[model samples]
Target: MYSNLDRPPLNVTELRRGLDPFFSQLDVVAETGSTNADLLARAADAEADRSVLVAEFQTSGRGRHQRTWVSPAQAQVALSVLVRLPGIAPADLGWLPLLTGVAVADAVRSVAKVPAELKWPNDVLVEGRKLCGILAEVGTTGKNPTVVVGIGLNVSLTEDELPVPEATSLVLAGAEVSDRTTLVRSLLRDFASRFTAWESAGWATSELADVYRERCATIGAQVRAELPGGDRIEGTATDVDANGRLIIDGRAVSAGDVTHLRPLE
Candidate 1:
């Protein structure tokens, strides 16, 4: 069992003290169902873009395809940011996952001193084991047309505490530093800058593609993409296009869960 004895609860006062200069809103709750769900529901009244919502515990946190993500209390970082990308075409919104993935990989590597690679579209991995999962959702019904990007990072969980066999944590990955506050703050800063540049270009450039490609582990791997409707595609992942779709065997797969497969002997 992973004891959170050494991990202190996140102090909003301390977070605001360090993050206020760059962020307009930084909130942390003792517990919640999901930060993304909370922020999505509150987006209409949100003060501005980049407003962050973090929860120490989630009763029903979810990932892509509605998979539940339950982490040990205080042993991980569950956070979501409300980014308002008004007027950006819905078609280009697919980039949100890749965008956030790049930010996470960069920030984690910088702070934790552990090499992190992005598994196309979202998952963040360290040494081929998942260290983080990202979920991006766009509000389609309300007047607030904002994107909620949620990240769940395993920080201090022990091997016994891991929810799945393929998952990892910063502590398990041998991170030189494993402070959640510092890592979250750094991620916000990196995401903000990357988003600023991408937004200013009116979603018309590949300014982020090059960097995402460099950090993506799926680009040159043999993979299996399990598509919706019980169909699957197996091929070499060649690249991710400007719209963030995985190009496998000359097919642009916009939505699917890709599994990396071992190369044949």
Candidate 2:
């Protein structure tokens, strides 16, 4: 499936070689409707644990709250992973996305040699502009639940190509944009290591809460949360709870569109 990619196939080959020690299997696709969509389909047909799907371009990429994620070929890293955690209740699945955000933030800081912070819910920011995004979808079979974690990172996009004015790429943020292969490998390695630790501890929320708080940019700032019920709550971003919900002014918000508000100088 990866043979016909617009970029050289050796990039993925190199990535696979680097990640050989960490992951059991990796699947690279040249083009797809969406990496998350493909992995979910594959997971439903055959339960493959720790499987990865990466695409150079996504024809129908998705974002949080059903937003569209569009990126040009060789400009971004679009990937998804299929994870199976046993004995984990459905109610506790919110941590998956938060955990993934922490992973991505760590990877970007380590690889790009620049600081990156996470916005509540699952957005990575550099210089207060979005550099990456994560979407986690949990689906349950008869007995097992599958979590497909999808990540999209802007690597080397021009200002005109950015979907939103608030978005920025690694290069734009004054960080060196490495090859796609290196970026993907580094991200997978960090995620796999963190996820292993998280699962082994039975999805301990306290362990991740500290790391998330340290790397979060929204905490202690005034922000606006666009709630699902068509109401907006503007408050100080306080903390993230054990369930990974963002605490705004002492209120636990599980789901909402968070917009960081300008602070008064």
Candidate 3:
């Protein structure tokens, strides 16, 4: 499925070639309108099982809360993967983003040589600054559940290119910002390996739970979750449930915007 080779140059070709042993199908786009958009459109026509879309630049990228994600051309990794989950209940869909966040934390740790942590539902943080953003979208099309996991990572962006004040890149965090292709390749490989395990044992397996909790930045800390209903719940972050819900005090928070109350030492 190496059809988009004519676009531009990327170092991810080597990474894709290495990943050939794991995935049966792969697709890389030099520049796309948006990887998520392209995959969603294709999912409407084809099964798109285990297919990946990697874009060098996205003209219109989106994140959680439907916020726009900004990136300079070739300055970040915008990737999406389409998978078909059969017999999975709609209620279990929330775990996909959490699974993705863990996968990303694993990948970044492997390549960046730094410890990464998960901020609630689907954000990756390094040194209390955002390093990655994950958005998982699920829909039932013709009785089959299609899940698109989109990941946007700040790889080599300069300070001026950052869209927000709190964003940080690998280079800024004292990690070398190598070729975007290599980083994306490593991410997909790590994610595929973890995803296979998660699918086999489910999210409750000790291995998955331990890893997520170890990398989580919110557990055992006081935090405030901003709910859509304009209600704020303040409590000590307890744990993350098997279904990827954030456990605050005794309540299972399925969705909200969380802000850690105290700084980590």
Candidate 4:
């Protein structure tokens, strides 16, 4: 049996002391149903901008398309961040999740020392195995709508504990997993920096697209994208467009479930 003791609790106090000034609010709970949901509810408040929520265990964590994400207690980094993006246009908002993917991949590569690449539309992969999933939801709470970005990163889950066979963890990828505090800090800081820069540039995509392209593994690969309405498209992915849509076979896909047909060589 895998004891929960092996995965210790996060140091909320230390995290707050380190991360408070950047975010309007930073909270860490022992457990929650979903950090994204909680943060979305909080977005109704006036001071919800830059609010960050983290959970040690999620009872009802969800991913894109309502897919449930389950993991052992204290085995993953389940977190959500809310940012008021009144300045950014709705069309440009698609970049938020992709930006998050780049930040997460960078964090994993720097902290875990693993080569983390990104699957289009925001799945972090290590050696072709999914290590994290990102979900960004829009909340029309105040005069300016808010965007809550949720990230779930596997830190120490064993093979049997994975939600899917294609999923992996830092430990399984031969990375250290004891100090989740550091990983959390790195992820938050990196995201904040990139998001701030992107917003400062009036939601421009030049720099963000460049960074996303460099870290994205789906580009330059054969892909099968299952679009909405039960339609699918198969082609070679060439680029991520200026608006953050996956460009597959000359088609700019705004939304779809992309699957790589072959491994990254």
Candidate 5:
């Protein structure tokens, strides 16, 4: 029962109208195969860093674990932003996904007017149903390297458009506003602020950590983590370590698919 509604073309002029200091360039395309891959290929370009590429519709979008992500055409906020951290300690690169998660939660709460929280590394959930997915990829190695962070959010999709039973859209969450443009602006605004603070502090600050813990829905939850190489563990998620890894039962999980268990478990 999906409607004939397609997202209106992103207003490139309005997006670039004032121009925030964090981003030097912003390009909105009518559509693309994959914003992450597209930006990754261009990461070496001088203008690629501090630049943004937003696709109105992603033909080949993906999520964690190479899971296919599908949404109604133009009915989501699908964009990738590039950043270069020059002289940044490589150890701190793990925080980009968490940082992006925090910013996405902030934007979702502010724009959608819903109670949104982060699911560990980078999933945004409202009432336990996923609303957004974020993927952070590192590209190139040098004094300054690029990390492209991409976020895909379901904005106005109807129930029939959901790609998974566990997924929900902003509209389904009773969001007060489902305008893609507004959500994009708010997300970029919040991300820019957090990113600037993180960069200014040389990635040694704890503000992002503190804020992430406060907004993280996974911490303190009994969970099961499916790690790479066919390893699995179940325990209560204690805290996010300094390296941004999920600490569970004295083990640090760098990458995994976490499933939150019920309270009685």
Candidate 6:
């Protein structure tokens, strides 16, 4: 059993009482391999729609590009939310992660009082240090499609506890509050509200795209996109197109690992 005096367990009862009506189901576990994996398996069930799973610790948490995400027990908010979208087109699904990034940045900004910005493709950064990582996976149940969006936010982790030198926790970033429960609740509520609005508008990209661009720090920054198959593109990040692809030097890139290039002296 993982125990930390500074980091207490989440209050599942309070979470359910406050968030149950908004989500199909709300659950919190002491430890799990990955909330995304667990929710993806549950997505096979029809009732898994809008399910929310928050784990106090994720043994094998994963980030984008098959990267491992690890944090000390009770030191972060490891959450995954499952939503089924039967009416949305497959081509437009790329916006899901971008939308999630917007919600996460907004939540962190509101609760943590930190200036959180989006690195292209959904990594949340505070003062150029990563504070959260988001991963969105797609699945199918019957004819409808399911999306499990996982978010791992650093909460109370000290500098030594960080998995990477470039990562920052809320406490380390001087957040006004680093309570995991509050942060998780705020993140879910914001995501649900934004997602519900977008879905109601037939998954439109106009509003979401505008908001994402404004909050994205990568836009207009010099970047080097390391694409799959060992190809790379280095140029300025101009904008995020209607399809949510990063526009690099007028080229729209759909998939790649992007690095912000520092200016020369």
**What is candidate 5's local distance difference test score?**
0.87
3 versus 6: better lDDT goes to: 6
Model 5, span 1-265: residue lDDT tens: 2234555766777788745788888888877888999989988886668778888878899897788887767788999998998887788887988899999999988878999999998899999999999998897778887899899998888888889888888988999988777787888999999999998888774888989999999999999999999999999899998888999988899899999998774
- Score candidate 2 by TM-score against the native: 0.93
Candidate 2 lDDT tens digits, 227-259: 988988999988888888889888889899999
Q: Pick the candidate with the highest lDDT.
A: 6
Please provide, for model 6 over 1-101, each residue's C-alpha lDDT reduced to its tens digit, 9 standing for 90 to 100: 65888899998877887783568788888889999999998877877789988998899999988899998889999999999877887888889989999
lDDT of each: 0.87, 0.83, 0.78, 0.90, 0.87, 0.90
lDDT of 3 by residue, 12-66 (tens): 5586677735565777676677788777877765546888888777888999888
TM-score of every candidate relative to the true structure: 0.94, 0.93, 0.89, 0.95, 0.95, 0.97
Top TM-score hit: 6
Which ten-residue region of model 5 has the weakest summed lDDT? 1-10
Segments of candidate 6 deviating more than 4 angstroms: 141-143
Residue 12, model 1: lDDT of: 72
lDDT of 1 by residue, 57-167 (tens): 888999999999998888899999988876777778878878899999999999999999999888999988999999998865233368889999999989998989999
* Over 4 Å off, model 1: 1-3, 20-22, 46-48, 140-144
RMSD of each: 2.2, 2.5, 3.9, 2.2, 2.1, 1.2
Q: Which should have the higher lDDT, number 4 or number 5?
A: 4
